[model samples]
Target: MNSVRTIFQDGGIYIALYAYLALAMIVESIYDNEAFSRWTARAGMIVIVLLIGFRWNTGTDWMPYLRVFYTTDSSSDYDSVVFGIDQGYVLLNRIVFYFSDNYSVFLILDASIAVGAVYVFIEKSTRLPNMGVYLFYTSYAVTHFMGSNRRMLAIGFVCMGFLFLSKERRIWEGWPRWAVPFGIAATVHRTSLAGLAGLMVSRRAWPAWAVIIGLLACLGLGMAGLPFSGLEWLGGTLAQYTGISAIDKLVFYTSGEAELGTDVNVALQAALGVAKRSSVLVIFIAYMRFGNPSQYAQRLYNIYIIGCAVYFAMVGSPIFQIISTYYSIVEIVLIPIIFAEIPKLKVPYILYLLVVPLLLLLTALIPYLELYVPYRSIFSTF
Candidate 1:
């Protein structure tokens, strides 16, 4: 059937991306040259651009975003916040709308900005940029950006700031530096606040035992049937910025009307997924114990640990899980640094080179929360 063909064709591209990176890694291992690695990473960008930029109607929000593109006007006051959209995003959309009405243009532009930002962030920030790109394509790209249109753009800007702050770690050059990007991200999605919270807390040194105790407490609360309905205030506050009213938001969260709450089955799946992914944390730990990383890298590792702690503590709470995701973006830089430094490891590097790829490949085969599945696109369908 044509539907099967579409899934293969579209999904094949992702598989090919994994293959391409695997081949590149093998080559890098043989040659042991930086030039090959850099060029390969740059080449990978071209593939990503093609894969993400050309696709149509593949993401869950594609039609909704298309409708938004058609409906949004360039003539409106740019500074005035459109209840559902960020001011900066509104301005960008209006500017794009000025030139043409085709929704594809917006898609192309968005894909470019997001993909390009990740590329630059990885290339400039990490020694093994290729690994960063590979992890991004396999782990985060389509699932995060394609379906969720606006927030990913904001996250891109936040990523840009994150890279910069990784290099320079002061108020003049660090967290304060990310303020503007974080502000922009908040406008695009209220979830940006979670990222900001992670960044702020990441600077402090939280004891491992204390973090463990806190996690136990949260999990205990979940087991006790807390229902988490009390957190409806947060949703109500977020609704103030969106077109949706507070009463509707309350109903949705409290009544289980929205696909917002997680049952035990979902939580178990999430726990397994987290455990699989958190295996990468071992590499970070190895690096810290054996090799001396730059201060920025250490800071990032700290943030990653904090993120992991938060995730384990709140695994049962979907609201808190969102917060954990924002923090986990540290993996982009962390994974690569771990890989590049594997040579200095006291143990054999072969285990990681074999295991990571297999894990990512397996994950890619699974559907992405019903948001990105079967990989439908206008290019293939029409």
Candidate 2:
């Protein structure tokens, strides 16, 4: 039993993860019954534990705070400001770090987020237990990026915010209440403020002319060859208001290497850039063909998808990558909804199931393989 625990703790355990993912995929593909799905969901929980166990060696990004909490007389001012001192996580770490202050906690957190996300996807998706869906959630895009602990918390909260907005009873009354959680997330990670924008877009009704004017203005600004200067000025303004010099450092200047990182190929990146424009195109068509969504929920989803598309196209910077990632959270909800609603060709459905995961995996691998040399041993570490 001790030897079994030791083996599982070692990097050799990732092979078990690979096997688990493969088996889970097969099981999901073969069974569609409620009882079977529930069983698979439980198996998914087990896989989550294994995956977390594999991450045991990978250090938590927030471990320094845990050390400060225990060892130092300092009053956790740093923790308060940075959200490194949240009650739930701090207490969780206190207990876990007592045993082993290694990477185990991070793994647990990552696994929890992945499991929660998968559970949500499964609940929402109309398609029966399919290998593609499981594979999609397990892929690097969701598992590595979206499931990264702190970011995942922000994402999970944002997803909850979306859920609140989507609920029929809560739609009218939820906005005021939703701000609190959104604000908490923004405090933890300012990037989460994007979710607030998402909330606003989701809730409000905009005039058709107003949306068109906004698009034209964005395009005009992009076309005027002044976006860089505009971004710099905006950064400076933000820095002055916030008194954080880092704001001016902005991702564009600091993340040039990351923007040009190897994770995204020139061709695929170009394609993504092109696809960004499709939001405007989608909105225009959706407007012309089906008309605007009648409910606040559908309207919000449409606006978010379109807004992200345009934003990605206009700014192909690393900062926007974070924004793009958050936007894709909405896509997780939207894609399955669309697949269920649209009477598309069967081949397109099959192709979408196959190609999307392949594309996401390639996107995730390129960056991990090319830009992040230090973390390359992530696989080996597991």
lDDT by residue (233-277, candidate 1, tens digit) is: 555555556545434444455455556313225655566656654
Error of 2 at 134 (Å): 4.1
Shift in Å, residue 253, candidate 2 = 5.4
Task: Quote the positional error of residue 302 for candidate 2 in Å.
Answer: 1.9
For candidate 2, lDDT tens digit of each residue in 215-290? 5676555445356466666765665554343463463353243344343455555445445344434533454345
TM-score for each predicted model, relative to the true structure: 0.79, 0.64
Clashes of each: 0, 4
Those runs of model 2 whose alpha carbons end farther than 4 Å from true positions after fitting are 1-32, 37-53, 56-100, 114-118, 121-147, 169-184, 202-228, 237-270, 273-297, 306-310, 342-344, 370-382
* Superposition-based RMSD of candidate 2 using all C-alpha atoms, in angstroms: 7.7
Global lDDT scores for all candidate models: 0.63, 0.48
Specify the highest-TM-score model's number.
Answer: 1
